[model samples]
Target: MSGKGALSGTEVATHNSRASCWIIVHGKVYDVTDFLDEHPGGSKIILKYAGKDATCEYEPIHPPNAISDNLPPEKCLGPVDMGTVKRVEIKITDQEKARLGRLQLRPPLDEILNLHDFEAIAKLVMPEKAWAYYSSAADDEITHRENHAAYHRIWFRPRILRDMTHVDWSTRILGHRSSMPVYITATALGKLGHPDGELNLTRAAAKHGVIQMIPTLASCSLDDLMDAAQPGQVQFLQLYVNKDRQVTRRIVQHAEKRGIKALFITVDAPQLGRREKDMRMKFDAEDPDEVTKSGGEVDRSQGAAKAITGFIDPGLSWKDIPWFKSITKMPLILKGVQCWEDALEAYDQNLAGVVLSNHGGRQLDFARSGIEVLVEVVEKFKEKRGITFPNPRFQLFVDGGVRRATDVLKAVALGATSVGIGRPFLYAFSAYGTEGVDKALQILHDEFEMNLRLIGAQTIADVVPSMVDATNIHSHVVAVPGDRLYDSNYESMQHARLRETTRAKM
Candidate 1:
C-alpha cells in the first residue's frame, strides 16, 4: 500500500480499525483515519465504510476533487485492486420503490408545458434528501416566496405591434452570443439529482447554444466539464473564494487557461444561511451516537450546504478584488450584489458588471429579489453615473425566481442584460436527465417567441422600460394574483410530526 501500484482488498482490510482506516474511492485507496474527525459530515459516516469502497456514498454530496483536495499526498496509499474488493449491497426500501414507480408515471416530456411542470414532477420523484437540499432556502423562507411573488406585481403594457410575424429572443451575455437571454446559473452537487450531474447541463447547454456558469462546488471536476464542452462552447466560472489564497489562485488561473469567458465571483455568502429542511435531513441520516462523538464541540448537523462550504473564506472583501484582477484577465463580475449602492460601487470600481442577486434567496432571508434590485440599480445608475440600460461597457445581470420567459423579458425590459435560471433547470434534469433540460430550454425558446410577439416587441432591444409597469413591484402587502401553475408547484412548509408510541402486546 506504500507505492502507487494496485493493492489487494485483503491488504487494505488489515488497516480497517480507527487507528489506521483506509477506504476505496474511484478505485483509489486513501488513509482517512487522520481525516475522520475533521470531515465536515462527521466521523461516523466514514467509519461505517472504513477500509471499504465509499464511492457510492461519496459521489452524490461531494465534488470529484474533494478527497484529493483535502487529504495530503502522502496519505494517498495507492490504487486499489477493485476486482478483489467486496461490494456493499445497497438495499432499496419500500419508499424508494414507490418513488421509482412515480418516476415512471411522469408525464411525457412534451406534456411538460412550463418550468413549473418539471418542478411538480421532480418533487414527486426526487429523493427526500435531494429535494430538501435543492428546495431549502434561508430561515423563514420569506425571501424565497417573495422572489417569485415579486414578478406577479409587474404588469405588462403591450402596445399595438407594427409587425409581430418575426421576433427573436437571442441576446449576448458578457459579450458572448446566447440562444436566449438566459444562462444556466450555477448549482452545486448536480449528482444529487442525476448521476451525470453538471455534465448533463454542459451537454444540454452546448446543444442549445446557451452559456453555463460552472459552479466551484460541482460534483464533476472543472476539467471534466471543460473537456465535455464542444469546440467553441462558451462557459463562465462562479467562484466561492477559498480560505487558502494559493488554492484560489490555482483555480482562477486554471479557469482562465481553460478559456473561461468570464469570472462571476459569489460575494453573498460569508456563511451559509440556516436551511432548516436541509439540517433536519442530516439528522435523519446520521447515527445518534455520532452526534455526541465530538462531545458536542463540533456541530455536525449543518447539513449538505455547510459540509461542502467550510473552505470558503469568510473574510473575502473588496480588498481581494484587485488580487483577482491581477491573477486573471477574464472579465470579472460580482455575482451577489443586493443593493443599488453596492451595484454603483462595482460600477465605480470598473469591474465588468454586477449581478443584482441575493444568492437565489439561499443566503439572506427577506433580501430583495434580483429583479427588484435590477429596478433600483437601473434607476440609480442613470441618476448617479448618467448611464442607462444596455450599456455595453458595464452589464447588469439578474437571477432568482425566474421561471417564465415573460420574467426574463421583464428583467430585460427594466434593465438586465440577461437573467440566470437555476432551480428550474435543476428540476428539469432531476426529473428526466439531459432530455428534460433540452425540453426545458425548448419550452423557454417557444415562450420567448410567443411572449415577444404578444408583448409587441420584435427583439430584445425593443423590450424597454415603458413596456412594463412596476408601480406595484415594491408593494409587499398586496395580495398577488392567484397563479395556478405556481400554486401547484409550491410545497408549503410542514411542522414536526409526532413519533408513534408502542403499545403493550397481549
Candidate 2:
C-alpha cells in the first residue's frame, strides 16, 4: 500500500462498503473509510463513490491536495497501476456539451477592454450554477444595486493645469506595499468557475505586486495558494469564525505561522443570506436544514454558500477580539465593520484596521454600500475618537461595487487606506483564467494612469477629500445614473436548466 505501481483498480474496488472504502484520486488510492463521517458534506456522497475513481467528484469541490493534506499516513494507499486499472468512462450529457459549446464561443481576451466586459463574457461562458452563485446577493438585491449606485453620487471635482507628466498610483495597504490602491478581495468556491481556483489570484497578485485576501471557503486549500506564491508576495487571510473556538484558534494560529500578513475577520454574515438565485440550485439530498420548497421558501439550491458555511459561528462578537489578539501577532482587522462607531471601537481596541463592508451586499438586504459608510465612519472617527483621517493607528478599508479606478480613487480620496475588488477578478478568472486576471490588472493600471492625471492628482496621496464633492455621497435619496454595463450583465431569475435528459421509453 505504501509503494507506487502495486495496487490494481480491481483490487481497490473490493473494499467498497460502509465497513471499508477505497477510492482513487489523481492516480493515488486513498482509504477514506474513517473519513466519511468527518466530511463536511456528510458521509453519503463518499459512500456513493466507494471503490471507484472519485477524482471527478472530488476535484470540483475540494482542492487538489485536500485528500493528501487531510488524510493521515498508512490510510494512504499508493498509486494505482494504470495498465491494470480499468478506465472509468464518463457519460457526457447533451446539456454539458451545449454548455461547453457556449464556453468555446467566448470573446477573445484582446477584445475584452474592461472589468464589465469580463463579467459579460463570464455570464455567457460559465455554467449556469456558477453564474448564479457568483452574481447573487441578498433578498430583493436593493443593497447590491445600491453598492454600485453609491459611487455615482460622488462626482469628481478634477483639478486642471497641474503638472501630470508621470503619475504614480502605487501606495501602501495596511503598511504593506502595493502597486495600486486596491487589493484582490476574497470570494468563495472559485473552482466552480475554473479548476485552478484562487491560484489565479495568487499568481496574478504576485506578478503585479498587488495583495490578495484569501477566503476561508476558497475552493483551493490555503496552503495550495500560498505555496503557489513567489517569496515575499503578501497575502491576507479573511476569517469566517468557526463555531468551535478551538477550530478558530487553530486556523488563526496556522495562518499566522504561514506568514499571513493580516487577519480580516468577517463581521457581517452572522447568518448567511437567502440569496434566492443561489437557493434555487441547492441540492435537497445533501441538505439537512433545507427549507420546504414552496413560494419564497429557503429551498436547498443555495449551492456552495450554504454547503460550506455550516462551520461559521453566529456567536462571534467583540468579546472574541482579545482572544484573537492573544493567539496571533498578525495584524487583526474587522472585515465587515458597517459604521464609524465600530471603526472607532476597533481603534479603541488597538486593532490594526477596519474594512467597511456589507459582505458585498450578500449578508443583509438594504445595507448601505461601504463607500457611503466610509463617509460617516471618517466623520465619526474625527469627532468621537479624536482620530483624524489617515490615522496611522487605525487604517480604514472599503469594498463593494467598485468597478473602476475612479471608484477606488473616490474611496482613497475620502479616507480608505485602500479598496478591495472581489467579483471583478473572479469574473476575470472565470472567463480567461490566470491571463484574464493579468489583463484585468492591466486594465486597472491603464485606468489608474489616465484617471490620476485627469483628476489633477500625480500620486495616490494627492487624492484628497477636496478633490471630490461627496456632499451627496451619504444622501441615499438622491438619484444617480445607473450602471448600464453591470445592469446588462445581470440576468433575471430563471430555473436552473437540467442537463438535456435522455430517457428510455418503457
Per-prediction CA RMSD (Å) = 2.0, 4.5
State the lDDT at 412 in candidate 2. 94
Best by lDDT: 1
TM-score of 2: 0.87
lDDT of 1 by residue, 1-506 (tens): 23347899888777877788899998889999888777767777787788788999999989998888789999898798887888878889999999999989999998889999999999999999899999988878889878888999899999784699899889989889999999999999999999999999999999999999999999999999999999999999999999999999999999999999999999999988888788777766766675576443346456778778888999999988889889999999999999999988888788999998888778889998888888888888888879998899999999999999999999999989999999999999999999999999999999999999999999999999999999988788887787788778877766777756799898
* lDDT, residue 198, model 1: 95
Question: How well does candidate 1 score on lDDT at residue 420?
Answer: 93
* lDDT by residue (tens digit), candidate 2, 1-506: 23455788889888888688898887788999887666645566677778888887777666454576567888888888756666667878787798889888988888998999999998887877788889998888888888989999998999999999999999998789999999999998889899889999999999999999998888888888889999999999999898878978888888889899999999997889878777665453354432222111322444456656766789988899999989999999999888777888888899999999998889889888999999998887777757777666788899999999999999999998899999999999999999999999999999999999999999998999999999998788888888899899877766556656689898
TM-score of predicted structure 1: 0.96
TM for every model, in the order presented, reads 0.96, 0.87
lDDT of candidates 1 onward, in order = 0.89, 0.85
